[model samples]
Target: MPNLKIEESNSLISKAVIMTGEAPSAEAVPVSTTRTGQMMWKDTFYAGEPDIEAVFDVDTEAIQLYQSQASIKYGSIAAGYSVLYAAFLAMGLYGIASVCLVIAFVFGVLTRLTCKRATAAFNTGGIHMAITSSCVRYDQEKPMVSTAIAVQDITTCTVEQRELKPYCGLFGTNKTINLIHLRVANGSSSKRYVGVKDPRNFARLVMTIKNRPRSAAPPVASSEIVFR
Candidate 1:
């Protein structure tokens, strides 16, 4: 399969990366207008009817839109090692040259592998969320993006409006755009951004339900959901 990097990352398979500064903007949509859950609010991305209590919506920014940060760094490492290996081989240092070659190969593999699984979710690409009492489920459109968030893992959720030219340029305007920062208890570096119609209210909604205990709903399979 051809390895694909989401513009920011370097991909050996891709000769050049074309960047267009297009801010991803979409109006927040209701999961179900006719069928409302007591606690769960689901988009078409989720399957199975558990009457899962759906709550407020979260317009998510996919990790696939961000994780290319490491691609060029790894590619540079591989290239540096390959150059050192060539120099060593030319100087009759076969043992060291072989080791350098091995290191180069390892880094090369990592450069390729980093293009996949940028987020915890499986190829997710939706901007809206299917919310529950304790978790926020996202829709998947492309691969390597996040799919869900456990509310218990969250320590605090806050929105910071800033004017910036982000790496992906997925969401930002000439004026300050709302960037909701969801800090976790474990302090994991991996984070997903979200764009919503009203960021302050969205952040408030997340905090209000952040402490609710998760439901004992049956897990939904990816293949089972119908992607809209």
Candidate 2:
């Protein structure tokens, strides 16, 4: 009789279970923070979600400034007209009062819409934003559409800031808000980052990180412009 030997590898992985293995780790996750802000998340969890293979920056300050500005704008419209409406009514000018009421209502509606957009953009308690070489993404729990935008698809990220003014007119506030207007390809599609105080830094980060594909250079027109 002959004795046979069988040695165990003691590894968690089994030889028979070779087809499936541990997933590969994501690359280039820095241990330190960037100059702009702090990184909140380095990876994504939800399916079909953003592939943020970089740091997720959280703004130190809340974006409530945007909503405040909107409120001021709408409040002015509503308040100015509301006073007129009240005066017209008190003066027994019912028709004029009705017209002022309608105008106020219309302007109030615009304010509501602006607030809604701001909510999606960055009205959350804190802005969770991430920028990779491939795309840009943010945490918008109730976004109008997908929150991720491919780098190539992004045409420009410009700062939409209100200049400092000592006073305001009856229709609007002195300084409305500071936001980032993100214009994507086709120009029609867009996104907004509301109440971002440092809009220039935000825009610069996105523009610098994203690597847009360059078009092939055209041939020189005067290459064959000789007398031949």
Report the number of the highest-TM-score candidate.
2
Error of 2 at 76 (Å): 2.3
lDDT by residue for model 1 (1-228), tens: 232211111111111111112232353223332221212223344446453334333333333333344555677899999999999999999999999999999988887755553443233433445445556565545442445677556655555554433464445443334455666668875344544334443443444454333359432211110001
Error of 1 at 44 (Å): 3.3
Lowest lDDT 10-residue stretch of candidate 2: 219-228
Error of 1 at 162 (Å): 7.9
Candidate 1, residue 191: lDDT = 47
> What is residue 197's positional error in candidate 1, in angstroms?
7.4
TM-score of 2: 0.47
Clashing pairs counted in every model: 11, 0
Which runs of model 1 end up more than 4 angstroms from their true locations?
A: 1-28, 31-43, 47-65, 68-70, 89-110, 113-129, 138-147, 158-181, 186-190, 193-202, 212-228
The C-alpha TM-scores of every prediction are 0.44, 0.47
Candidate 2 clashing pairs, residues 3+ apart or interchain: none
